[model samples]
Target chain A: MPFTAPPLFPGDLFEGAARLAASAEGRLSAVSEAPARAAVLDALWEEAAALGWPAVMVPEAQEGAGGTLEDLVAILDGAGRAALPLPLAAACGVVPAMLPAEAGGVVLPFVASGEWRVAPAFAELMRDPRSPAAAAATEGGVLRLSGSVIGMEAPPGATHTLLHAPVDGASGLILLPLDEGGPGLRRFERLDGRPSLDVLLDGVTLPGTALLARGEAVARAAASARALGTLLVMVEAVAAMGALVGQTIEYLSTRVQFGETLSRFQVLRHGTVDLYTRHEAARALVVSLVTAAAETSVAELDARTLHLAKLHVGRAAREVAEGAIQLHGGMGLTDELPASRLTKRLLCVEFDYGDGAVHAALAA
Target chain B: MDAAGTDYAAFRAEVREFCLTRCPADIRALVARGGKLGRDAWSRWQRILFDHGWGAPNWPREYGGTGWDLRQRHIFDETLAESDCPPQYHHGLRHLGPVLIEYGTEEQKRRFLPGILDGSVWWCQGYSEPGAGSDLASLKTRAVREGDKYVVDGQKTWTSHAQEADMMYTLVRTSQEAKKQQGITLLLIPLDSPGISIRPIRTIDNWQHVNEVFLDGVRVPAENRVGEEGQGWSYGKFLLHHERLAGANVAPLLRQLARTRRLIEEGATEGEEGRRRALEHRLLLAEAEITGVRALGHAALEATLRREPLGNTAAVIKLTSANLMQRLDEIALDATGHRLVSRFRPVDGNAPPEGMEWLQNYLYGRVRTIYGGSDEVQKNLLARTLFGH
Candidate 1:
């Protein structure tokens, strides 16, 4: 059975969330036991596609599931708890939040069915000092774009990337397809075993439809997408921390030394309590972000809440990850147990979008 | 200011208007300098609130409060802090008034609620004795039954503002036959009662912020006892929860952070480039912390508004807010740069440096992590809950 977190806020999404969580938990269990990355990722993607996971935030008029951000949060939270090595949040959350229904109809279907996968590069655009400086020109119903973005955590096997670029003195959202071994594209491995891409787009050509949005619409959509993406990353990290906290407590209760279980030791118990409190604090930040979102339309995102959630949840994830690993003693150091896997996922989540230093600078 | 589907924007504007226009100028200035608003000035502010029907934001309407929800209360407090308005006298209003409503008898409520609402009476908490701080259940204060009164004898230490208060809600040992927590009783003792003596305790800031009160054969009527005999422990626990949540007050920290920003801007012209950058970085982290604490406070408020148990979330807020307060104070002092070495005799004729205020605030903020269940104590409480069956 999947580990279900209590609903942080009351909503109609819980029913759909319960069903999706169970499906995700079942598939992730199988993925965790797989011996290799390539086949495991493909199977995970196919299973998610069959389950219609990526279309959760798309509008129903676009032949998609048509769910709210709350629904997407529940799905990504489940993915985080399972430590599913996929860009579920990026594909399902940021993409839908960023695209209008007309554009969503065309792009989401390919993404939902696993024919194409996409990861968000908004954080890179925000943090990388080297501006994408992307300029776009319309050429007889086609678009030419050129920009360079660094530190993008491109999901393994991702077929496309979504980012914002300046076009004609206005911000434009661009969706670019990836060509295997393409020039100006540098691929590497991330700390969490995911693929990282540095794309140097030089006069790349695409259909006019690739300019998903421009001007004020692009600004609002980008803000909404960034806010949604940050919160979703927090949801996933907090979910993983929740799982780690439970696992650590159980380990403490079961592990024995010096004639007593580790839980019975006051020092150990207090250390666990610190970790639990940090996890709860992060969870509270996520809840407040959700509440703030509910109070206003997602397009008019609350900047302070968004910034606070990113900075606070990022640090909390790091502390909980290190503390959970430390508390498990010898077993925590090994990949056989879920502790290390969960820790690695948490560390990856912490650095994925702006990280602590980047966010701290923004906040400062 | 929108909350619970209601737009609090109008309410916020009304509060801001009152704080900016109606609050007494001297009183606002007093609060701005971090000066204590003694009984008279506090009563003047309370009268203003009472006249405006904003006397008690958290109390029930039946008790003459504004009947505002948690969001309104937060807005009122935040707006007041932003405007440099004197904070409410929370001892009787926030701490004792709620306990009376929850567990007090009709008579006790009738006698105490009005005074607290109208700001006529000042009350200090008497739960801590010299020997019974964090491990409070082991208190040696005794209260033996004597006809129509309870003869109370105890030494309560750290009685904040006791000298300016009229009554103290104390915890006394009523029985020896049960667990340490089970044998205590909460009683309200008038400070003027016979055989009660108070002594001021000077601190690091050389300010008499707290006092030591000795209750020797002080007679408090039996009617003053809250709830049943041997039930004070539970009531005390409830009050402590309220105290811990209240201790996470975010308004003053926000004000301090703004002040730090001003200090940083003022220092930028004189400081070296690298030093200014370093201070700005620290200020950034502090700003992030203030934001986090404010969000946590909102979460706790939402939880309370929903009538949900705050549980360990309260502890988390208390711990983090306390840390943030001290951290902000340090940043403010550091922003003062070379003026940091102005240590001198209090009686000296030399005028204090510009950093004197920050120095005093830094000294005063030391109690944030040490009071209202210290950081270690909160950690232990959280641990017990996690480990409990």
Candidate 2:
């Protein structure tokens, strides 16, 4: 039988996100310094936590909405369109999906190589500067582990860390209490001024039940979930880029240059048209990927689809972001404007899950 | 509705069986090797098909054809495409046969239609010239009146199968004083006429299927003109529509994609994640593109079958079909890796199959977007027809 797109939800996810963003348009447009931005991030996290978006994908038996991966992707895309400061896609969408049903009240803080520093309080300190170290794992069921898991963002009021470690020739994910983890736990400041910490597990022990069983299965599930979450993030980024390009076109239409509106220039119009074409191709490919993933049960096939989607969408997002900034002129680069923030966010998204080149090579 | 009612299940089965029995083993091998069958081989195959009365399925019943409807035509085309049959000389069957049936004099029909069906005379097109390609109306090929005959003298470039063709269906300038598009006439000229020269233009990839024909004062009887003088434009336009319609078939491309998938699957290591992923992605994209072509082609065929006038959007279907073929070639070559680079030579008076066949396909596939009409021309036609630009 021929395939078809699934039934669309009643409300347009994008319009709802746009409405929410419009309510806070002033704050979103405001240029805030580092300290104020950190405060904003904190407030945004609380708001997101209140919304229970992080638990949306978890089963209903475990306090989640019992939503499908499609639902989480839609929510994350909405968040992206709103340009929300919270890492809801990672912390909520990916984290909950990775953890077991009963593993609640534990926030999974995402970390990358450049986001935090590794302290020498752990049993074995190894750093791969090339790869992102999002979470740490303990060797045993050592709740009070004697090792330092560094380069982690300490989401406010988190009780434990979902640590990933290689134990007994098998990689496992273990939950470790943060406060009671001895001198191994030390806080560090990130470039974005977010609160991150290094937990040093100095031979601390814990109950054997603390270890998350089926480490390999959990790791694979986490990777897949993260990939799905990243897909949503990439989609959201494309939507934002589309909106930005539209706004730039409107601005250029009225902005006079040499007694004529900038939009009156043929070159400008053609350039925007070219941008629109790229955006359309990327959007179409992404939608196809989403549809394929929703329909296909084949894991490797789905991964291939996702890889192609990511490669095309990532490249298009980068182009759109750069074009928006260039078209906006010198004011675009300023901290006082939202364009620079959007540009930074887009750059971060381009490399968030995987770079276009990496994904293209993978797809290839 | 019943499932069998919507599907041509029975017709498909019959065609498949017929192909297995009637399709010659030598021809099948030649097609499989990607080589063109020689004249004798083609004659044998055509006679076999004619014996079954399936030689000219697209022709009207009055003209020695079965006169099947659109669905049956589609089934026949699809079966032939999926089979190992050699490339049927399209100039006779696709181009000239339709033109003669549509606008030919009674004598012209009687003289040429049988040769087309019996594969007695191989035909080639003489449309393009050095100065007139995409803007084809500006052809300078002159055919001046000389009593009961017209002397033809001009050059036609990009003439397919001309080197082996027995006859040339040419558009000659019959009136220079008339408007640019007016006063041209279509004529059937013998390719072996004195002062006629056929020279192969080696393509970038060195395929010899295409050539350039120079008409140096070749004489042709006035009776050879298929239609009224100055009506060549209309006939040519009709011929183009037929060509585009036939070219829209996607079965060959679909078969190529299936072959490519098998090749990639067989070559890829089980644990080679990246290469396997890439192949899988390419396959999906190809499938999607093919589906799009099928959807568009079906719509167009339905419209034509209903005897409804197809608006200029026909160009859109043609453009998409050509693009799909080009993309299929690109993917096939990529999948084949360096096997595509190997040298090829024709054996036993038949074209080589593996390396040179693919190289030729790659090279000729580029012209799909250029010939019949350049892609840009199609797009412009679509723009005008759909958007009134």
Candidate 3:
């Protein structure tokens, strides 16, 4: 009856990640609050990298673990459950999946080794491939990139960015250093108090080696990255929402009014039940999306299903979080309760990538 | 596991074929057209399921039930619901049958069980009185012991299908000396008794599905009492649990959503903006349906493997499905931007106009949350059980 659901797609590696996240729960709260410094981020990344999470979706031959999609998903679920407060979502979801196998020999070790923290770009580009936000032109055999993605802001302690641009009349991936932004990178605060960046690759130069994959391969990697991103975030969402609702249920049971506990009120009980079902459904939908795709390579993951699942998970998370707030009444919005944190996290998740409305159109 | 899980794939295929092939075409047509079918048609459909021993998939097999576990029952229900099969009439089949199987005496079972199985006798509930509903322990419908018979004199309101029923399962106050709930006794009263009268109460949907039953000095032998005296409250709650099982998923909402999507695709909206709105709401309903399916899967696991009794789950489903069902209809109306026409006639046609149906469905679906267990009552019960206040 408690809100936690059985892990729908768990593996031995996922179990290890879940345990690691559990052990590091209190320690990672800072990652979500502020962008970790180079040393702090490195230490955090090394701890996770030591467990080989970054290499989960990469091939083992490329100095990676060659883990299944479920490994990445479970790790994200654990991180989100602990509210690890890091770019772990991007680290596990976008970075490894987006870096194509073709680029693994040159760049894979750094990425797989957690030496690079590549902030994702081209969220807007993915939606409108015809007019990508970033454009590229080659000069002296070096690619110069210029284009700005919406919803990007420079992080306080950023290193690398997985920038997507138009290369050779097709979408291509490039690893650009964040500090050399040339004034195109704008930084802003995300809902969860994390720093986000928007970058204009104007006059930004990438060596020919920075061209990871072009044509179908780049597009495929980008799509895979986005799909995996949604799925992993959803795993985190399920936990956060579950914890929030559980706290709400606990509050309703003890918080007394009318000489009776709120839990004794059928209205509140049924409302929590409603939230419970939503959490359960989101878990089932997301687990299916991740586990099924794990059977195939990341590039083959279905985007439409991922979009539909995200749409559902995002809405369900909001409902559970908001309903928890509403039922908690006065204590809901207060920082004393985790409901405050969950509400903020839910808002962030909803707007991340394409929201329900955007996914709806794409699904259509 | 999902619907595509290997364990249930074949079972789903079997149920799907049975529903598609065996369900009556007229009933299917009535359902697909968003119209009501005749009672005889409903009974005929039930008879087919009865013949297959699937009339009550959750019941034990020895008493004409299918003896399927939770997942199998879910597959059967989902298949039938999606096939546009007329919903099974539940007055005698789902509620009272389960109660009787669980608590009825051997002689009582012999007398009543077969009738329910054969789909012959129709029964209606007689729990809600003029004063007692959500707080049902306070019911005042009284019965006085007279030798070997109990003389009953009271009224039951919101008696669904009372006009068509041959018998009524009632809760009457037998003793008022101790507690409100402890003094209650359940009696199976014949609706055809000399002093019994049934009056129709039309709902907001202009449907006469529910009624008021007036009992004046109706006499029933002591044997007609279900189980022991002073246990009616317990039996009623059990019956309600059975009734609420249907709430687990709004699978039927999927059809309404599909129809709405088709309406949008067929140019139900006027402008580009309106079309976009229609598409957005349609997809929202789709997301809600996926959520419902996921909940259904988890509920099945809990009920089957964990042997968790259907307490919070039924209420959760009821509350959630009611809210979603209402939302689904609004989405349909949003697509068509239709108002209920004054002269809409759903009965005369194979398929009513989409706008009219959407409007009617929207209006009628308004009461789904209020009936069965009212949303408020369900919430209170779920709160108490889930958190143990």
Candidate 4:
């Protein structure tokens, strides 16, 4: 019997995004390898924006597509499938969902049009309240931010950042511009080839208008954004894990050892099956989370579901990465094949947002 | 009922109510003690369901089933498990009844469907033999044609509940063909046939759930064969799918985890703060595993209901569920430390010790990955689907 499954949630949309990603495989590889990748990233974002993906979760009243949660997941799944090294999750999900609807006049247009490559840096504020990255002081309608948020996604090509900081004894959401190059900003590549930033702020000044929301409003937005981001990145990881399974299966089918194909070996075959199971388990978790998210708005996203998905998807990603690497043997250790790159991507996913240990604590 | 038209909440409430009120207390007690239901207990419950017009939840209505949709069937199973109902008859209702309904002759269905529906007859599967298990197609149980009868000679091991069953639906080699699976035939044989002997095997679980059935030239009528002579492999595969779908039942795993949590709380000491936290951490991880398993199992069940070919779904579910079951069992055993010895020792009466049941359950769960299809076997089959041999 053929191995079949119900398509990823919102099947047709997922398939459309999958086809787009599949067609962009050549450009994606080029973008991954290019030292000066800003142009490629821009071009890719422009295409994705043209497709209206960034506007998916935005309301139609705000000149956005007003798509469902599954639509966003579909785009993320596509990005993950092709190992697209862009901040699609931030631009498409977190940033859009985090910016409050009432504050749309100030930021919704940029988000809806994809004119601003915004990376959300609320993880530190949500997880570590005392962290310096989330420290800020507001005085007389002026905000002074002092601290650095390290390794935020898409910082190399990002035009702005949506973050949360402490303001007058409460959390405040802020959008800071990143267009001008400065010594405080250092760009680096993550293990998975995505651009990460070590952003250091030495008492940077922003108008009071930069504060999107304060107190209860900011806290709720941060929670909703974190939930949305966690789920999108997880969807990507699971999709990438699926890609790794395909890569490993293809390798095993032809890689000969001891006068027979590796796929012919019982041990190797069993290893592949284990990889597939992990992928399925992770996929299932993502699907359930997506379904739940689809039924509720971003603010009402279930924390328990988000935490559970994070914990299991993180674990599954690592196991699958390890299993895929082992099955590839000598080829697994080198960068000659996609296995190594996909392995790194999965490991990166395992640590993103919060690792298994973090989510396990939260879930408990 | 259609999923769109049905109020599942109301449906769930209805099933839960029925199960709570209709399931006998004695049967529930037996199941709660981790005791296997005997013929009488199984028949009693089956008859109750039959009388209530729910003899076969998965079967078509024409075949004496309630014809519940996938969601309704899932709700029913979950409700039954929650209510501590004894496991419904599976070998006959799930495995063979479907096979017969799909491939059996009218006369055969007339002869078998009623017994399975009312639970008057018990059926045990005879797929795994002494020499053939994971590689079932290589099974060596031979049957020679003799006029209107086929003389069978084989030793089938891991025949679960063979001693309690009245009949065996078995696979036997009928001719020597190039492909091992091609020559096989499925036959329904009466356990009381002259030359059939069943010996119980005591497993590590300290239970008599499985047996060894030795057939010394036992004769089955030609009409007993299901489908065409050489089409048994397909039928057997069909039955195996049903067998694996049973792994999708996540209620028991969740129930076991809940029990483990209770045991953890019961063993807590005021001063053992660090130990309590550690156990709680492990319990949290176990809950996550069950959650993932339940999610994946539900997805796979939906795919099955759509009649879609589940590529590695069945195998994946079986393998994952098996792994999760063993993990939960270990945690339960750990929670009740000294009671682990109960698995190795004998119990005096029905009510032995508080944790004795956990020890036995943990021991029995060891077979989850071994029986049906071993973990290795499932992986190999899945690999075949992905990469052609």
Best by TM-score: 4
lDDT of 3 at A316: 84
RMSD (CA, Å), each prediction: 21.9, 20.1, 20.5, 21.5
Clashing pairs in 4: A3-B311, A4-B311
After superposing candidate 2 on the true structure, give the runs of residues whose Cα lies further than 4 Å from its correct spot: A1-364, B1-8, B36-43, B87-89, B269-273, B342-356
Off by more than 4 A, model 3: A1-364, B1-7, B241-245, B267-276, B285-293, B296-303, B308-311, B336-355, B385-388
Point out the worst 10-residue segment of candidate 3 chain A by lDDT: A123-132
Expressed as tens digits, the lDDT of each residue in A1-364 for candidate 3 is: 3445555456675566666655544454433323342234345556777776766766778777777666666676655654554566776567767766766576667767766656776635322212336777667878877655544422235577776667866878877776653435444444443445556566677777767677788887787777766677787898777766777777777765544677887667888899889887887787676667767754576767777888788778767765665576534533334455565566456556555655677787
lDDT tens per residue, model 4, B325-374: 87877666545532223112221122333446675676566566666666
The DockQ of each candidate is 0.01, 0.01, 0.01, 0.01
Q: What TM-score would every model get versus the actual structure? A: 0.51, 0.51, 0.50, 0.52
Q: Encode model 2's per-residue lDDT on B280-310: one tens digit a residue.
A: 7877897897898787777777778778876
The global Cα lDDT (0 to 1) of model 1 is 0.71
What is candidate 4's lDDT per residue for A183-285, written digit by digit as tens? 2665555556566665666668778888878778678777788777788878888888888888888887876543466688778777889988888888888
CA lDDT, every prediction? 0.71, 0.61, 0.67, 0.73
Order the candidates by lDDT, highest first — what do you get? 4, 1, 3, 2
Model 2 agreement with the true structure over A1-364: per-residue lDDT tens digits: 1111222222454345445545444564452343444465556555555555555655565545666656655655555554554455555555554564444433322221111111111111121222222233344443434344543444544456565555443545565655553335444333222344555555667676666654667556555655665576666666566565666677567655344676776656776676667667876776666666667621333676777777677667766755655454423333334444455455445444554534667677
DockQ result, candidate 3: 0.01
Worst 10 residues of 4 chain B by lDDT: B342-351
